[model samples]
Target chain A: MWRIAIYETVYIIIYGLYTVFEFICGMFEYVYQTVFFTCHEFLFPSEKRARLKELVSKIKKKPKHLTVLLGPEDAEVTDLANLVIWCLASQIVFISFYDHKGSLKKKEEKLQLEVKKHSGDTAQVIWYTDENSNLENGFKGSKVHVKIITDEDSKMSAATITKLLVESENEDFTIENIHKHFVKQFRFPDPEMGILFGKDYCFYNYPPWQMRLTEFFRFKSAKSITYAQFLNLLVKFSQREQRLGK
Target chain B: MSWVVDNQLTRFQKFCVNVIKCGPIPRHIAIIMDGNRRYAIRNKMGKTEGHTKGFERLAECLLWCRELGVKEVTVYAFSIENFNRTIEEVDTLMSLAKEKFERVFEEKDKIMMEGIKIRVIGNLSLVPEDIRILLAKSVLLTKDNDKSILNIAFSYTARDEIVHSMKTVVEGLESKKIKPADVDADLISYCMYSNQSPDPDILIRTSGEVRLSDFLLWQISQHTQICFTSVLWPDFSIWHLLGCIFKYQRAFPGLKKYADECQSNRKKLNDRITSFLGDIEKKRMEQMEIYAKT
Candidate 1:
């Protein structure tokens, strides 16, 4: 009778204990999702951390020359900014973001504050997106040299303005932008960037100068993205075979 | 050395001359010869006959790729997903493989003498044992071929290649020589079966599918993708390939493609998180099982 009682007790503890353990796991998952995913909750799951931690081995303090293209804001502009910050923090890679904060002249004037605040002491390109602009107070000393993406003699599309920002004057890259005036500035490239956060095949034509052979990665939506998601993209990217032009 | 020739000339005699002239092209031009089933049903043939016809066309096209200066050519002969077909159909495919490999062996095609290697890519373990042995011997006999590389993607899926690569990386990571952080696109590419060759410069797919259908997913990023609608793959000619190449050459001057930004670390975490709880539906389900059981 004592053995039977002990058996029953043991059985109750084993399976019932498993049930409690499962209950705790469910609670942990709920807490993880609600806190980390829903709120700016700090503790990330191991799977989520796997990609970034994997890249920790390949951090380049100073990689080969880096080219930065400033993009105009639509909806996901801030997302792009966070991405840049994350990219920069991960390595001392070369970066040049934009001077154009908003379209309004006054807002654009005040936009230098965000540039100054975030740029700290980074290389910058404060070139005007248009052929000519009256520059006076707000645009005085943005340490990096400013080069005009479009000249008066050579008009270009608005969508391709950002590509023109690449320092190298690859004619093939610039030719596509000569006449196309796009409004948004950051759209899809020929081969879009893998970590892009935008919809539509329509490239807003930022700097049409630099995009000679850009890989295009399109996102139908960027509303619910997190830093961890960006890392995941890099992980997927690392597995790609970049067979450029045969 | 005129690279541009109009293969669509109305004259049949003109077609013969053009075929003779098309040479010095890329040695290994792989084709995703899709749309056999639909083509067969339209022609009032059953699906099984459709595949046999497709097989015939494939054999014929190899002769064309060979004649026109292509040393090696690959065809997406079967996809892993295609295993979902009826067992009878799969049996028919195995029979076809046996017969085809036997014919290639019996004829002692000059290609074998010239050192053209015949490889069956993708998960061949799923194939029947006998068929696998025949494939093994074909590969072995042609292993030293320097003339051309012929890859048949039987039960192939590109994304699965990536997943397979990731699993391989875990093994590499365990060895401590390959740090997890050192894993990048180039590293992964170098480890793949096709890493020896440059990614196919021109990926030609028949049946007018806009999407790559997971064909050569990792290898192709900036290659010229050619999709044809009117011509069924079996009926495709070497002229068809040349015509598309000419068009690609013309478009080259205008369309610009870019390489990816090389990175060391951490972007993976961000992208992974954003993509899901929604990637690799199979593994995710398994992981969900753990969490659900809890």
Candidate 2:
């Protein structure tokens, strides 16, 4: 019993010290990133677009489908629109935005307007919802498809698809069939890259069926996301070698 | 003097561990133990030797997690994709797995005392018969213990697990045992191999991998904290475990809030689906009954 008491005392004292240490480290990182990002932005204001374009050109392998996990703190529609325009510029055909609260999904029109404003006549933006919709065939030249995903799209789709397969009498309900259904339903290929804009690296329930081989990266803050950071992430994605369980 | 210093160093380490225990600890932790082969190459050892060292590290990690009050742990022991490896390596891994399960028998009394329940979550049909028997025996032996759970994801992939769950649901529906209304996210989750425990609170991947690599994609929610470390599996230490736990503690509050919100949202979706599919459920039951009669 006395041994337990001594251990508890030591634990309390050490825990206090540990928290203090962690706080100091966190503050230092925050300050460093703030200064560095601000200086980088100020120092290279005019060359930002060209540099981003150059970085994009340098990426040999670009992800066809990219999913962004937006945290509550980073759910700004304007920032999301900027990301969409960036994806268009980089020739990424499919981009999906996910926030747990479904706040972006509610304001889909405003987001589309924002994207239109930024993308102008350079790109055709198609908002994809499901496979059977006529919008699925609307893809043509210079087309970008944007999906606003929420928690409902993950498990709910699984249940609904399972129900459909179970009810279909003539069709063979196999894994491959399910995969085809999902591809048609979601109208997007499996995400090759996923970026999380949050303080931590949680997916927040991004579609489980789609992220089997997705390489995920994290951005510190969505509010201060820069072109360089996005370029760096693309470079990182290009450099990664996916073994796919081999 | 060296021995004395070592003793004191270990004592301090113990003290540090105790301090960490004062914070919020993850109830369940999952790990993607990567870079065993890399460790082997780096150390100029055979691949088998690296895997052996990785297994030793796993044993050490389990002990540390138990000490820290983590109730459940799931590890990516082997993947279905690993079947593509060289025949010699595959045979070695199978033998190694067989040997480990045999040791489980030798340590039965200790395992029982520790109250660790052994569970192998994956497609068991893929394994050889002998290793499968040993795995089944270990699971049966430790079935009653409840103090902690060790889930070995052998011959597993997240896609395979999801498919397995969907197959179960589909089979149930075909047999008229389950209704269409009953198939929801929670139900699908319950059908998963790792459904015995809650979703992991923290998933740590060693060797600097930022990908889930087909591990627990459905089970991990938006709130599951992920920690990617550059340490190889064989080189992973208790300090690394402690560091992961500390990070989990710092993020616990935000994670809990997000988890709660997700739970409510899931419930709402389930309820909506149930109501919407009520008529379809009746029609499906009738169809199944007729099919059964024919």
Error of 2 at A216 (Å): 0.6
Clash counts for the predictions, in order: 56, 1
Q: Write the per-residue lDDT of candidate 1 for residues B1-294, one digit (tens) a residue.
A: 011112334465344434334322444566878667778888998877877788877766655555455666767777776677778877787787778777667755565655667776776656666666666666666766777678888767664555454444444544444554455444555445465566554567776443355566556533333333457776676578766554443333322232121123214443432232123333333432343233
Docking class of 2: medium
Give the poorly placed runs of model 1, Cα more than 4 Å off.
A1-246, B1-24, B253-294
DockQ (Cα-based) per candidate?
Answer: 0.01, 0.56
lDDT of 2 at B47: 89
lDDT of 1: 0.48
Best by lDDT: 2
lDDT string, candidate 2, A107-220, tens digits: 888998899898977468888753433354555557788997766678778887778776675255455777887786677898999888876778777888888888889887
Cα-based lDDT at residue A147, candidate 1: 26
For all candidates in order, state the fraction of native interface contacts they contain. Answer: 0.00, 0.74
